[model samples]
Structure formats: structure tokens, C-alpha cells
Target: MLSTPISLPTVFVGAAIIFLFALALYPSSLLRWFQRKRYQYEVTFSLYMLTPTEKFIFNSILFLFLAMVSIAVALYLPRHVRIIAHRAYYYVSGDLVKNGTTSAVLGTTAEILTPTTVAEAIGSA
Candidate 1:
């Protein structure tokens, strides 16, 4: 009989890793696509509710949650590895945010104002 080089576990592990990587990179693309699809014609709102720091924190939290759940499911259901991998990828990369343009504007504004604050006046002015 011919020798089988790759085992099922190895394949599953590789798929899981790829899924996680995709998830990590999905946020920005997914968010942008979602906004374009759903609110393409609508007037954009302000990002007054969340700062860039808050946005990053929120995205990180979401990514962590997805990673945890994906890992848990993958560990518990080895046979359904493919399904778990797909779900994890989708969840991780899926767009959870709606208005990215507003956030961009807010971030830009913050950047612009940050250097003009009174704290910088002592040295520059």
C-alpha cells in the first residue's frame, strides 16, 4: 500500500491557521464593503460615539471573541473542521462596523487638533 504522508489532523490545523489569519485581516475590508453596500446612498453619520482608540479596542475584542469560539469549536469537533474553519473565517472577517468614513473623518480631525493643543504651546509658542 502507498504511504499516506499527510494526516487529517495536520490538514485541519493548517485550515484553522489560515482561517485565523484571514479573520485578522478582514475587519477593514469587510467594514468598508458593508458600508458601501448598505449605506451607499445614505448620508453618512459622525463617529462622535467612538474614538480611534475605542474603535481599535472594539475590533480587537471582536477578533478575540471570534478566535476563541473558532478554536473551541475546532477543538471539540475535529470531524467538522472544515465547517468550523469556514465559520471562523466568516465571523472574524465579517464587518461588524457600519460607518467607517465617519471614523476616518473623526480620526483626521483628532490628528489635526492634537498638535494644536495648549500642551504643545509651551515649547513651540
Candidate 2:
């Protein structure tokens, strides 16, 4: 008996389908983790009351620092295959596009346009 070898495209699509399935099923847990990591400092700060000026200054500094750190990490982090795999899983399986949650959360025309820019560039030009 002989079995046919799976073509690369089929394998890739299959992997994407499986990843999406996982994301759909377990997105809450993934989201919880992402929220914890992303807003941990904000959660900590919520315990204190802040005057308007203090709030503005604190948030401005915190966000600036976060932006810088995020950029630095994006540039310096090791490009690991597993990270790519997980992100691929999230993008394919996550309800980001189908449910339109990402756009709703981003709440800006520019944010909405950004994904289209990437997709169009990658798909057609």
C-alpha cells in the first residue's frame, strides 16, 4: 500500500485551519494573557487616585516608555520560528478579521487601513 505525499500548500493551509480552530476555541485565555502582559502597569496604577495633571503626565510618560520599549523589543527580539508559528496561528484562527473586533478596538480609520495596506501589498502589489 502506498500513500500520497502532502503538497506544501495543502500542508500550509491545513496548518492555518488548525491554528484558526484553536484560536477560535481558546481565544479568551490567549486574550487574558495578552491583556495581562499589555496592561499590567495600568492595572497596578488603578489602585491610586490621580489628579488630572498627574494622570496626564503619568500616562504620557508611561505610554512613551512603553512605545520605546515595544519598538526596541520589536527590533531586538530574536526571530524565533515558534513565535512566528504562534502569531500565524493567531492571525489565521483569531476572530480578528471575521468578527471585526480588532477594528472595533482600534477605533480609527488609520488602524483600519493599515491591515488592508499590508494585505494588498502582499497579495497583489
Candidate 3:
């Protein structure tokens, strides 16, 4: 049996649901995982052992770096991923052969059988 193709939005929504479920059910485990994973490398220079002013500056820099990375992935990566996935689906499904068009455009379904013969319709106000 042929499987139905999942849309990009469906994939994202399903992922978000799983993420939320994990957060709700396993909050302590997630925290433990973070604590276990962190500080794996030997601290040549320790952030935790810094003076108050130095700690604040180090935290500020770290926060900025995290924010930049998050924003870059959130803003740009989805659209890029979707375009690539759609192209891959096109090749895999042979949608061009079956549908005789690429992905559906967001508009009316009425077919344009012929080009309209245009008369000069602009009137001086």
C-alpha cells in the first residue's frame, strides 16, 4: 500500500507535540541530562569560578551567542529545509508526471483556458 506524503507543517507540529510532551513528563530528567552533559571538558578557564563582574560579562557573551544561533536557525532554516524537501518529494513521487504541475499555488482553482484580449480600460478621472 502507498503511504500518503506528510506536509512540512505536519512534520513540525508533530515534532512540537513530542517536545512539549517530553518537557511536561520528564522535566527533571531533562535537567539531569543537561547537568550530566555540561562540564564534560576540563575547565582550563572556568566560568563558574569567575569573579562577579567577570561572571556577568561571561554570561552576557554566552547568552548573546545562544540567542544569535537560535534566531538564525528559527528564521532561515525552515524555509530552506521545506524547499529542499519539496524538491526531493517531486523527484520521488513523480508529481510532475501525475499532476502536470509543481506544488499547488495559493489561489483560485479556475483554469485559464485562454489569454484575455485586453482593451484599454483605463479612463481619466
Candidate 4:
């Protein structure tokens, strides 16, 4: 059986379909997100009426949020990328596993999906 390489747009559409299916299964989650966004938009984030202390407090909270995000990206982003690349490499370029023998794509997906692999990935970063 010849396997055609999936195009980028096709992959994106498939992903979107899967995402929509998930949302369909748990629609309240999506609705809650929309509701949260609506509520969030109701609040005006301005430093205009703030006293010096309030401004400092607001800036501190903003800085902390940004710092945490930066730290998470610095720490986890590389590991996440490495895991995906590692899995893709194994998937695209090795001996193929026989079917009914696996729930994973090549039996390798399950092999690489271990917590050990994830931990190893995290440790390398």
C-alpha cells in the first residue's frame, strides 16, 4: 500500500475537524470560554485612575504573569518540540510495524508515548 504524504492544509483541516468534534462532545466548555471572554471584555484595564501604589501593584501582577509565561516557554517548549520531532522521525523513517499488533500508528507511537520518554525529554532540556 502506497501512503501519500499529507499536505499541510489537509492536516490542518483534519485537526480542525477533530477539534470541532471534541467541542461538539463537550459544547459547554466552548460556551464557557466564550462567556469568560465576554466577561473579561467588560472590565476596562486602565492605569488612568490608579494611584501610584495601585499602578505599581498592577504592573507587578502583569510582570509576574509575563515572567511565568516566559519561564514555562523556556523550560517546556523545547521539550515539547523535541518530543514531536522525535516521534515524527521514528514515524517517517523506520521499519514499519505490522497492523492489529498496534493501536499506535506503527506500534511506535505507544512506545514513545511513555512517561519515561516524556521525562527524558524534559530532562534533556
Q: Which candidate is the best by lDDT?
A: 4
TM-score result, candidate 2 = 0.28
Summarize candidate 4's per-residue lDDT along 15-52 as a digit string, tens digits. 99999898888878769899777556435665656787
Candidate 3 achieves a global lDDT of 0.62
Let me know the TM-score candidate 3 reaches against the reference structure. 0.40
Sort by lDDT, top down from the best: 4, 2, 3, 1
Model 2: per-residue lDDT, tens digit, 29-121? 768898787576656787246676887898889889999999988876755554565567657775333333343444433433556654664
Task: Enumerate residue pairs that collide in model 3.
Answer: none
* Segments of candidate 3 deviating more than 4 angstroms: 1-45, 97-125
User: What lDDT tens digits, residue by residue, belong to model 3 across residues 1-125?
Assistant: 64998899999999999998988777787687776655542154475577879877877898899999999999999988877777787688644323222324322234432222111111211
Better of 3 and 4 by TM-score: 3
Q: How well does each candidate superpose onto the true structure, as a TM-score? A: 0.28, 0.28, 0.40, 0.39
Clash number by candidate, in order: 0, 1, 0, 0
> Mind giving the per-residue lDDT tens digits that candidate 1 earns over 1-125?
74978889999999999988987777678778886764543333333356878767866897799999999887877746655665566477542122233224333333333334433543553
Per-residue lDDT value at 76 in model 4: 100
Error of 2 at 72 (Å): 0.3
- C-alpha lDDT values of all predictions: 0.59, 0.66, 0.62, 0.66
